[model samples]
Target: MTGPHPPRPGAGTPAGRPPVDGNAAAGLLGEVLAVEVTTAVAECRGCGAHAPLAQAVVEVDAAGALVRCRGCTRTLLTVLHVPGGVRLEVGCLAALTGAAPTGGAPGAGG
Candidate 1:
Protein backbone atom coordinates (compact mmCIF):
# COMPACT_ATOMS: atom_id res chain seq x y z
CA MET A 1 0.00 0.00 0.00
CA THR A 2 2.17 2.87 -1.21
CA GLY A 3 0.75 6.38 -1.34
CA PRO A 4 1.26 9.90 -0.08
CA HIS A 5 1.84 10.20 3.63
CA PRO A 6 -1.12 11.65 5.54
CA PRO A 7 -0.45 14.83 7.51
CA ARG A 8 -1.83 16.19 10.77
CA PRO A 9 -3.62 19.47 10.17
CA GLY A 10 -3.95 20.53 13.80
CA ALA A 11 -1.67 20.65 16.76
CA GLY A 12 -2.25 18.68 19.92
CA THR A 13 -5.80 17.98 21.03
CA PRO A 14 -7.99 20.88 22.07
CA ALA A 15 -6.15 23.39 24.27
CA GLY A 16 -8.08 22.34 27.38
CA ARG A 17 -9.85 19.13 26.53
CA PRO A 18 -9.66 15.50 27.54
CA PRO A 19 -7.59 13.18 25.40
CA VAL A 20 -9.25 11.21 22.60
CA ASP A 21 -10.22 7.64 23.28
CA GLY A 22 -9.49 4.58 21.12
CA ASN A 23 -13.07 4.54 19.92
CA ALA A 24 -12.87 8.21 19.07
CA ALA A 25 -9.57 7.79 17.32
CA ALA A 26 -10.89 4.78 15.46
CA GLY A 27 -13.73 6.90 14.20
CA LEU A 28 -11.16 8.98 12.35
CA LEU A 29 -11.11 6.37 9.64
CA GLY A 30 -11.41 7.83 6.13
CA GLU A 31 -11.48 11.25 7.79
CA VAL A 32 -8.38 12.27 5.82
CA LEU A 33 -5.42 13.14 8.05
CA ALA A 34 -1.77 13.78 7.39
CA VAL A 35 1.72 13.37 8.92
CA GLU A 36 5.01 14.66 7.69
CA VAL A 37 7.55 12.04 6.86
CA THR A 38 10.02 11.51 9.62
CA THR A 39 12.24 9.54 7.24
CA ALA A 40 12.15 8.76 3.54
CA VAL A 41 13.86 6.19 1.38
CA ALA A 42 17.63 6.31 1.33
CA GLU A 43 20.65 4.14 0.70
CA CYS A 44 22.96 3.04 3.45
CA ARG A 45 25.40 5.93 3.77
CA GLY A 46 27.99 3.30 4.58
CA CYS A 47 27.62 0.48 2.04
CA GLY A 48 25.46 2.20 -0.55
CA ALA A 49 22.72 -0.37 -0.26
CA HIS A 50 19.15 0.38 -1.18
CA ALA A 51 17.26 1.61 1.84
CA PRO A 52 13.66 0.54 1.60
CA LEU A 53 10.89 3.05 2.19
CA ALA A 54 8.78 2.80 5.33
CA GLN A 55 5.60 4.11 6.89
CA ALA A 56 6.15 5.83 10.25
CA VAL A 57 3.22 5.30 12.53
CA VAL A 58 2.20 8.38 14.49
CA GLU A 59 2.15 8.14 18.27
CA VAL A 60 0.34 10.26 20.87
CA ASP A 61 3.13 10.74 23.45
CA ALA A 62 5.19 12.84 21.01
CA ALA A 63 7.87 10.22 21.25
CA GLY A 64 9.94 9.30 18.22
CA ALA A 65 8.11 7.48 15.39
CA LEU A 66 8.57 3.95 14.13
CA VAL A 67 9.57 3.06 10.50
CA ARG A 68 9.95 -0.41 9.06
CA CYS A 69 12.41 -0.02 6.23
CA ARG A 70 12.09 -2.46 3.32
CA GLY A 71 15.65 -2.85 2.10
CA CYS A 72 17.49 -3.07 5.38
CA THR A 73 14.35 -4.03 7.22
CA ARG A 74 15.54 -1.83 10.08
CA THR A 75 14.11 1.11 11.98
CA LEU A 76 15.89 4.38 11.32
CA LEU A 77 15.12 7.80 12.75
CA THR A 78 12.32 8.69 15.16
CA VAL A 79 10.12 11.60 14.12
CA LEU A 80 8.57 14.40 16.20
CA HIS A 81 5.29 14.18 14.28
CA VAL A 82 5.87 17.12 12.03
CA PRO A 83 4.48 17.83 8.53
CA GLY A 84 6.10 16.84 5.24
CA GLY A 85 8.37 13.87 5.13
CA VAL A 86 11.63 13.81 3.22
CA ARG A 87 10.03 13.17 -0.16
CA LEU A 88 6.95 15.35 0.44
CA GLU A 89 6.75 19.06 1.05
CA VAL A 90 4.24 21.44 2.60
CA GLY A 91 3.74 23.04 -0.81
CA CYS A 92 1.58 20.07 -1.75
CA LEU A 93 -0.72 20.66 1.21
CA ALA A 94 -3.14 22.38 -1.12
CA ALA A 95 -4.30 19.03 -2.47
CA LEU A 96 -5.35 17.98 1.01
CA THR A 97 -7.16 21.28 1.36
CA GLY A 98 -9.19 20.82 -1.81
CA ALA A 99 -6.76 22.87 -3.89
CA ALA A 100 -3.95 22.12 -6.30
CA PRO A 101 -0.35 23.04 -5.76
CA THR A 102 0.70 22.97 -9.41
CA GLY A 103 -1.62 25.77 -10.35
CA GLY A 104 -5.34 25.99 -9.62
CA ALA A 105 -7.30 22.93 -8.63
CA PRO A 106 -6.54 19.88 -10.69
CA GLY A 107 -8.33 19.76 -14.03
CA ALA A 108 -9.07 17.19 -16.64
CA GLY A 109 -6.07 16.60 -18.90
CA GLY A 110 -5.14 14.33 -21.72
Candidate 2:
Protein backbone atom coordinates (compact mmCIF):
# COMPACT_ATOMS: atom_id res chain seq x y z
CA MET A 1 0.00 0.00 0.00
CA THR A 2 2.98 2.28 0.46
CA GLY A 3 5.14 3.49 -2.39
CA PRO A 4 6.99 6.53 -3.61
CA HIS A 5 4.47 9.33 -3.46
CA PRO A 6 3.98 12.22 -5.82
CA PRO A 7 5.36 15.63 -5.07
CA ARG A 8 3.34 17.80 -2.73
CA PRO A 9 1.25 20.78 -3.80
CA GLY A 10 3.29 23.55 -5.50
CA ALA A 11 5.86 20.89 -6.42
CA GLY A 12 4.51 19.99 -9.86
CA THR A 13 5.16 23.33 -11.49
CA PRO A 14 8.48 24.92 -12.32
CA ALA A 15 10.44 26.59 -9.59
CA GLY A 16 9.33 30.14 -8.68
CA ARG A 17 6.01 29.55 -10.42
CA PRO A 18 3.41 30.57 -7.90
CA PRO A 19 -0.01 28.97 -8.21
CA VAL A 20 -3.08 31.16 -8.14
CA ASP A 21 -6.75 30.44 -7.53
CA GLY A 22 -9.13 29.50 -10.31
CA ASN A 23 -10.50 33.02 -10.35
CA ALA A 24 -7.36 34.06 -12.18
CA ALA A 25 -8.51 31.97 -15.11
CA ALA A 26 -12.00 33.43 -15.28
CA GLY A 27 -11.01 35.91 -17.95
CA LEU A 28 -9.41 33.32 -20.17
CA LEU A 29 -12.24 30.84 -19.69
CA GLY A 30 -14.78 33.57 -20.27
CA GLU A 31 -13.92 33.56 -23.93
CA VAL A 32 -15.65 30.21 -24.40
CA LEU A 33 -17.70 29.58 -21.29
CA ALA A 34 -21.08 31.24 -21.04
CA VAL A 35 -21.79 30.45 -17.42
CA GLU A 36 -19.96 31.84 -14.41
CA VAL A 37 -17.40 29.07 -14.30
CA THR A 38 -15.75 30.25 -11.10
CA THR A 39 -18.99 29.40 -9.29
CA ALA A 40 -19.20 25.97 -10.86
CA VAL A 41 -18.23 22.78 -9.11
CA ALA A 42 -15.43 20.72 -10.56
CA GLU A 43 -14.83 17.08 -9.71
CA CYS A 44 -11.28 15.80 -9.70
CA ARG A 45 -10.77 12.41 -11.29
CA GLY A 46 -7.47 11.90 -9.49
CA CYS A 47 -8.66 12.53 -5.94
CA GLY A 48 -12.46 12.47 -6.30
CA ALA A 49 -12.71 15.84 -4.63
CA HIS A 50 -15.66 18.06 -5.58
CA ALA A 51 -15.04 21.71 -5.00
CA PRO A 52 -15.82 25.04 -6.54
CA LEU A 53 -13.74 25.84 -9.55
CA ALA A 54 -12.78 29.01 -7.76
CA GLN A 55 -10.98 26.89 -5.22
CA ALA A 56 -8.90 25.12 -7.83
CA VAL A 57 -5.30 26.07 -8.42
CA VAL A 58 -4.43 27.89 -11.62
CA GLU A 59 -1.31 28.83 -13.52
CA VAL A 60 -1.59 31.25 -16.39
CA ASP A 61 0.93 32.67 -18.78
CA ALA A 62 1.36 33.72 -22.39
CA ALA A 63 0.68 30.19 -23.56
CA GLY A 64 -2.59 29.53 -21.75
CA ALA A 65 -4.18 28.59 -18.47
CA LEU A 66 -3.80 25.39 -16.45
CA VAL A 67 -6.36 24.41 -13.87
CA ARG A 68 -5.62 21.95 -11.11
CA CYS A 69 -7.63 20.33 -8.39
CA ARG A 70 -7.52 22.04 -5.03
CA GLY A 71 -7.47 18.85 -2.96
CA CYS A 72 -4.81 16.86 -4.79
CA THR A 73 -3.33 19.35 -7.26
CA ARG A 74 -4.23 17.11 -10.17
CA THR A 75 -4.53 18.60 -13.62
CA LEU A 76 -8.18 19.28 -14.27
CA LEU A 77 -8.44 21.39 -17.39
CA THR A 78 -6.31 23.37 -19.79
CA VAL A 79 -7.23 26.07 -22.29
CA LEU A 80 -4.92 27.36 -24.94
CA HIS A 81 -5.47 29.96 -27.58
CA VAL A 82 -4.55 28.26 -30.80
CA PRO A 83 -3.91 29.54 -34.29
CA GLY A 84 -7.47 29.61 -35.58
CA GLY A 85 -9.47 29.21 -32.40
CA VAL A 86 -8.92 27.69 -28.96
CA ARG A 87 -7.72 24.30 -27.86
CA LEU A 88 -9.22 22.91 -24.68
CA GLU A 89 -7.77 19.88 -22.97
CA VAL A 90 -9.54 18.07 -20.18
CA GLY A 91 -7.34 16.10 -17.87
CA CYS A 92 -8.49 14.80 -14.49
CA LEU A 93 -11.86 16.47 -14.57
CA ALA A 94 -14.47 13.85 -13.87
CA ALA A 95 -17.40 16.25 -13.95
CA LEU A 96 -18.26 19.92 -13.98
CA THR A 97 -21.50 21.16 -12.48
CA GLY A 98 -22.69 24.67 -12.98
CA ALA A 99 -25.78 26.49 -11.87
CA ALA A 100 -28.57 26.64 -14.37
CA PRO A 101 -30.34 29.81 -15.36
CA THR A 102 -33.45 30.95 -13.56
CA GLY A 103 -36.27 28.38 -13.70
CA GLY A 104 -33.87 25.76 -15.02
CA ALA A 105 -32.75 22.63 -13.25
CA PRO A 106 -29.09 22.36 -12.45
CA GLY A 107 -27.21 19.97 -14.71
CA ALA A 108 -23.80 18.39 -14.92
CA GLY A 109 -21.35 18.35 -17.79
CA GLY A 110 -18.01 16.66 -18.20
Candidate 3:
Protein backbone atom coordinates (compact mmCIF):
# COMPACT_ATOMS: atom_id res chain seq x y z
CA MET A 1 0.00 0.00 0.00
CA THR A 2 1.13 3.60 -0.75
CA GLY A 3 1.12 6.45 1.72
CA PRO A 4 -0.40 9.91 1.25
CA HIS A 5 1.98 12.40 -0.35
CA PRO A 6 3.16 15.51 1.48
CA PRO A 7 1.87 18.92 0.42
CA ARG A 8 3.75 20.71 -2.31
CA PRO A 9 5.57 23.93 -1.68
CA GLY A 10 3.84 27.20 -2.69
CA ALA A 11 0.89 25.31 -4.07
CA GLY A 12 -2.34 27.27 -3.78
CA THR A 13 -1.70 28.96 -0.39
CA PRO A 14 -0.90 28.30 3.18
CA ALA A 15 -4.58 28.16 4.03
CA GLY A 16 -5.33 26.32 0.78
CA ARG A 17 -7.32 29.29 -0.47
CA PRO A 18 -7.29 30.81 -3.92
CA PRO A 19 -4.88 33.55 -4.82
CA VAL A 20 -5.91 37.14 -4.16
CA ASP A 21 -6.40 39.80 -6.76
CA GLY A 22 -4.16 42.76 -7.57
CA ASN A 23 -6.22 44.95 -5.27
CA ALA A 24 -4.38 43.26 -2.43
CA ALA A 25 -1.39 45.45 -3.26
CA ALA A 26 -3.32 48.63 -2.50
CA GLY A 27 -2.29 48.94 1.13
CA LEU A 28 1.39 48.31 0.49
CA LEU A 29 1.45 50.53 -2.57
CA GLY A 30 -0.49 53.35 -0.91
CA GLU A 31 2.29 54.16 1.53
CA VAL A 32 4.84 54.37 -1.27
CA LEU A 33 2.86 55.40 -4.34
CA ALA A 34 1.40 58.38 -2.44
CA VAL A 35 -1.63 58.30 -4.74
CA GLU A 36 -4.39 56.05 -5.95
CA VAL A 37 -2.00 54.49 -8.43
CA THR A 38 -3.89 51.23 -8.54
CA THR A 39 -6.78 52.98 -10.24
CA ALA A 40 -4.54 54.69 -12.76
CA VAL A 41 -4.34 53.50 -16.33
CA ALA A 42 -1.08 51.82 -17.29
CA GLU A 43 0.02 51.29 -20.86
CA CYS A 44 2.37 48.45 -21.58
CA ARG A 45 5.16 49.25 -23.98
CA GLY A 46 5.76 45.59 -24.75
CA CYS A 47 2.34 44.72 -26.19
CA GLY A 48 0.65 48.12 -26.27
CA ALA A 49 -2.03 46.87 -23.93
CA HIS A 50 -3.76 49.38 -21.69
CA ALA A 51 -5.38 48.62 -18.37
CA PRO A 52 -5.70 49.94 -14.86
CA LEU A 53 -2.68 49.29 -12.67
CA ALA A 54 -4.95 47.42 -10.33
CA GLN A 55 -5.48 44.84 -13.03
CA ALA A 56 -1.79 44.08 -13.34
CA VAL A 57 -0.40 40.96 -11.75
CA VAL A 58 1.75 41.55 -8.68
CA GLU A 59 4.20 39.14 -7.11
CA VAL A 60 5.74 39.82 -3.75
CA ASP A 61 8.73 38.24 -2.10
CA ALA A 62 11.18 39.08 0.67
CA ALA A 63 12.69 41.88 -1.38
CA GLY A 64 9.53 43.61 -2.64
CA ALA A 65 6.88 43.63 -5.33
CA LEU A 66 7.03 42.98 -9.06
CA VAL A 67 4.17 44.31 -11.19
CA ARG A 68 3.66 42.78 -14.60
CA CYS A 69 1.37 43.40 -17.54
CA ARG A 70 -1.53 41.01 -17.53
CA GLY A 71 -1.70 40.83 -21.30
CA CYS A 72 1.92 40.30 -22.24
CA THR A 73 3.30 39.37 -18.85
CA ARG A 74 6.10 41.87 -19.26
CA THR A 75 7.48 43.40 -16.16
CA LEU A 76 6.16 46.91 -15.67
CA LEU A 77 7.36 47.96 -12.25
CA THR A 78 9.53 46.73 -9.45
CA VAL A 79 9.15 48.16 -5.97
CA LEU A 80 11.80 47.61 -3.34
CA HIS A 81 11.24 48.62 0.23
CA VAL A 82 14.54 50.07 1.25
CA PRO A 83 15.92 51.32 4.53
CA GLY A 84 14.24 54.72 4.70
CA GLY A 85 12.00 54.68 1.67
CA VAL A 86 10.80 52.72 -1.33
CA ARG A 87 12.79 52.19 -4.50
CA LEU A 88 10.81 51.98 -7.74
CA GLU A 89 12.17 50.65 -11.00
CA VAL A 90 10.07 51.12 -14.11
CA GLY A 91 10.21 48.81 -17.07
CA CYS A 92 7.89 48.27 -20.05
CA LEU A 93 5.33 50.75 -18.81
CA ALA A 94 4.66 53.19 -21.61
CA ALA A 95 2.42 55.58 -19.68
CA LEU A 96 0.57 55.99 -16.42
CA THR A 97 -2.29 58.45 -16.21
CA GLY A 98 -5.70 59.31 -14.74
CA ALA A 99 -4.44 59.32 -11.17
CA ALA A 100 -4.70 62.66 -9.40
CA PRO A 101 -1.41 64.04 -8.16
CA THR A 102 -0.84 64.12 -4.49
CA GLY A 103 1.00 66.71 -2.31
CA GLY A 104 2.29 69.91 -3.91
CA ALA A 105 3.49 70.72 -7.38
CA PRO A 106 6.78 69.37 -8.63
CA GLY A 107 9.73 71.45 -7.31
CA ALA A 108 7.31 73.92 -5.76
CA GLY A 109 8.45 74.05 -2.09
CA GLY A 110 12.11 73.37 -1.82
Pairs that collide, model 2: none
Candidate 3 residue 55 C-alpha distance from true site, Å: 0.5
Residues 2-104, candidate 1: write the lDDT tens digits.
8965645663454534445567554232232332222223344323444323332223354444433343444433345456533222211112221122234
lDDT of each: 0.35, 0.79, 0.80
Candidate 1 residue runs with Cα over 4 Å from true position: 1-40, 55-62, 81-110
* Number of clashes recorded per candidate: 7, 0, 0
Give residue 95's error in model 3 in angstroms. 0.6
Report the C-alpha displacement of residue 30, candidate 3, in angstroms. 14
Candidates by lDDT, descending order: 3, 2, 1
What TM-score, computed on C-alpha atoms, does each candidate reach?
0.23, 0.62, 0.60
lDDT of 3 by residue, 71-98 (tens): 9999999999999988989999988875
Best by TM-score: 2
Per-residue lDDT over 1-110 for candidate 2, one digit per residue giving the tens place of the 0 to 100 score: 98978658767345545556778666545433555588889999999999999999999998899999989988999999999888989999998877543324322111
Q: Which ranges in model 2 have alpha carbons more than 4 Å from their true place?
A: 1-33, 101-110
